[model samples]
Target: MSHVHVPALASFLLAAGAAFGQAPIVGDIEGKEFRPFPIAVTELRLAPGAEAHKSAAQQLVKIVRADLELTGAFKVLDPKSFIDTDGLTQSTVRFPDWLNVGAAGLAKAQLKDEGSKLVVELHGFEVASAKEGLTKTVSGSKDDVRGLGHALADEIYRYFTGEPGVFRTRIAFVRKVQGEKHVFVTGIDGQGGGQVTKGGGLNLLPSFAPDGKSLVFTSYRLDNPDLYELALGDGSLKRVSSRPGLNTGGRISPDGGKIALTLSQDGNSEIYLLDRGGGLLKRLTSSWGIDTSPAWSPDGANIAFVSSRAGNPQLYVMGSSGGEPKRLTFQGTYNQTPAYSPRGTHLAFTARDERNVFDIFVLDLRTQKVARVTQDQGNNEEPSFAPNGRMLVFSTTRSGARQLVVSNLDGTKQTVITTGGEHSSPSWGPFVK
Candidate 1:
């Protein structure tokens, strides 16, 4: 994939003699009541002599608008309601017209086609005070318009939320095709990626390494559920663990030096640690109950996994170096697939309720509070948090085909991002540099 080059076009400062200060944070992501910020993204303006790139410009605008809406933090206004189509310059933007359409912020961009690259000049404005808050220029290969769009979306997200965006990141999931299940990777928006595994293997539970260059998953290609690593750049495969029995749920540590996975070599399923090359490091759990699905915290200080030591499946947390495990969930009879947030403040997991329906829930480590993320829609499972920790990607049967869904922390904004197959076990990858 070609890299998107972003260079500063103008100083990232508010207009001189502006009437208002920096835009206040839209809403607290962790709060109960979240009011989406109203914003308008104007149609892309083609520079003089750049009319040939009109189709690309329209696609770029669609990508940015869709990305902003997917975050559930901004309500992108309809272009039909826009009263100002004069130009993209500061003097031509009518702040009163934007406010009249309930837009507190406005975004505009102009596209230019260079000899071998496409250039975009992006601008963000605060409608209330008519102050320009952001100005950037991004460029990429002529064939990589999507990359440029995602890069611009990331910049806009950072400008408003003071946090990095996951638009440029990727996600790995298992999709069944032609009677075989394989691992596939795609952009978080579920576009512009291809299958990562082949040879008719039943690959599952794919997780990304910290550097986002490769993935670790369990494949039954050899008649045993063994852990294998696939390089994203070259499609090369290497066996990481092939014990006598199950060796699944391979999750890399935050530092990218070790892996935590479930092993059943000792006659029972237990959590074990291994080096990147599949060498044994330590056995973290030894209980008779089945222990699996290990997840590492952001700081690599603790590991969370599911265990049945208490007679039922429950989530537990233990030191990465091996220690007594502490249970974290008590309300649900069955809870598994624990995924820690990027900030290590919460844990998202799958829980089965009294009605035998599985749903996703988040547990706040600080307040010991559990929040329901999905309900009554379908059987949702295997939630993976985005790099920003503000959203989640998981598989849901709400549409009767078991497609992947990306949802905000509150479940207020859920979007089906995949189709045409039964997708499951989503693992949201880290940001790509």
Candidate 2:
């Protein structure tokens, strides 16, 4: 399979923000030889007479530590190993103490209560340079204390990585409870999860709208495997596609102007392009074998999908406007569920090995190189890239029950976030503003 080169979409790079700034902490991420940087986060302190900040103070440190630990680029030290837990103030941080603890970076925070809200002051510093890297303040209602932690984590991440973190993003996944499958939404840390589909009979394959306020998924509520759009604002559900049979794998384009999905209304499983309102625009593939799991490139110029036209299920790349298809995978006998990274440099999917176990693999579009992301971990599948393109979320059965797992791009720092339920088909949502 050769790489397919297409003209660049002018507005692609500007979607996330201005051109992405170089990572403040540089390493060879593609080469997978970079060592994780040792970072230490001090326990959050509470202002005097602010007993209301007790719980939130503890939560702030927990969330920030978890977020940085998941990146794989940083090694968060245990708080018990800190010598100056309460003395590392913004103006008085002792970098020598952190360096003695084998940490190259240090983070400190303080929490205060204001009437009905909580305010947080966060700071980051380089242990080697002994210079402050970040100073910011975040505030939110005490009821939403977790949100403040996420905001502080994002600031710390940007201070050290230059790129924004997806701590504020959400994830949509399918969880089967008591033999019924329903769509559920959760924060990136797996906290604050609740069902989005209440009247659902069987809901699966959830794809978040680019705006992060809606989702497109396959449902059998009307006694058919039809597609439905779920509005998060009002819990409203509208049928997007109720064609004769097999309406599944619906993915909204990055620009939100089009949708590329698998439709079988024509008696053959194939990929089709649809307007945002579900009106058929054009059939992208007409194949005898199943062609499904269409993912849009960041530029919206190409789509990577799975098909069996090569005698076995493999990945294929084609133009979004309908054109000749080029195969993309040659190493795996079975490859499906292709997801294009937000950076447009790689495609992540699930591949089955000779031992009949499934794991995630990433394909470098530029070099046509395939790198295995998970192995010997109980059947990991359905990888979804975080908005930052530095992390991914997938479902794994390593704990004897399906759970959502988050990992870095190089397959390091894998952590299972969800503890209960049979969760699968996780899709990382876009950055929330």
Candidate 3:
């Protein structure tokens, strides 16, 4: 396969505001080498002298603190280690008082009732300037306090990290147990691994829609790995496409109104972008090559993917609206599954070297240079950047079996997130709120 050269006219970039504020921004990446942030959080106060539900308020504080910690971007100051401020609220925080505890950021929230709904108000502030960073309210049924707390966490995440928070997003991945494989969607930290497919031959490769209400993934529910769309939340199901020979790759657009996937129904594996309602938007690749792993840009103007159009699999950039493609990577001989960062200046993918060891790599879209994030001797692939573009979650073989791993995008501070089971095809969810 040879590199496809696309024309420059089709290479238009989206506005920064769109990328900076966009939700569900998807791209490929693993560990970032950047520095981590440290912060503290405290329980919101019940009304003055109102002590009917102090425990519930305390639960909300713990949930908020844990949600931020799960992002891998923030290091929450341990509540046990800090002096207690159990009854603090959004209205009563003295900026200097909290700062003296050595926290760079602070989180304070309150629980209230607006008619029949339970409303949780959260505040994120910078310690130095005492300036409020972000504030938002979440409303839910009285029993849904946990949901409300997670929503507040999303607001706090957006406050410090300009991108949408995955606090409310759902992660879909393949889980294998007792020689059986199933696809699942759970909280960002693998908490909600709800099985989407069962009794599998191999249910791998799960991708959620931009709305996080649905998921499109490859499943062996039919005894052969085929593409299926499973509506989430209520778990309604639909079969998106099941081509004759292959149905293993599918990705939804950022707008939640389209899909780009690889299909062999046309007699060869090729990339196709389809509308939300199942209309063909465009055929991206028409070749005999194995053209899979299609990831749409935030603006939906182009796609970053891995194609074996060249003799060896490599990362390539092509017009999302249908035009010639351009090679985005040239350093590696085996680069598969190229995902464009939401910021459009970076790409994350899996690359193999002469020794046949695969590692996660991020490419600087502007300088056209490559940086390896996983230096361990084992195999690391399938890197998906967080919505903030600062960290990525990927699968690593370092844990003796394939398991989930997270780290800063710069390749430092690596943390193996999953303990048991064969977990692969890890897709970090979008801002949950």
Instruction: Give lDDT per model, in order.
Output: 0.86, 0.83, 0.70
Which regions in candidate 3 have their CA more than 4 angstroms from the true location? 1-35, 48-55, 80-97, 110-123, 131-139, 198-200, 255-258, 265-268, 273-283
TM-score of 2: 0.93
lDDT of 3 by residue, 284-320 (tens): 7876678889988878788887778878787888888
The root-mean-square deviation over C-alpha atoms between each candidate and the true structure, in angstroms, is 7.3, 4.2, 5.9
lDDT of 1 at 312: 93
The TM-score of predicted model 3 comes to: 0.80
Tens-digit lDDT track of model 1 for 1-433: 1111111100111121021233434535434445788888988889987899999999999999999999888899988898866567678887888899999888899999889989999998888888887898989888899999999898787777667778999999999998899999999899999888989769999999999999999999999999999999999999999999999999999999999999999999999999999999999998979999999999999999999999999999999998999999989699999999887878889999878899988887766777788888889999999987779999999989989999987777999999898899999999889
- Error at 356, model 1, angstroms: 0.7
Error of 1 at 129 (Å): 2.1
RMSD of 1: 7.3
- TM-scores, each model vs. reference: 0.93, 0.93, 0.80
Q: Model 2, residue 369: what's the lDDT?
A: 70
Best by TM-score: 1
**Clashes per candidate (backbone, < 3 Å):** 0, 0, 17
**lDDT of residue 252 for candidate 1:** 95
- Window of ten residues with lowest summed lDDT in model 2: 1-10
Write the candidate numbers in order of decreasing TM-score: 1, 2, 3
Report the CA-based lDDT of candidate 2 relative to the real structure. 0.83
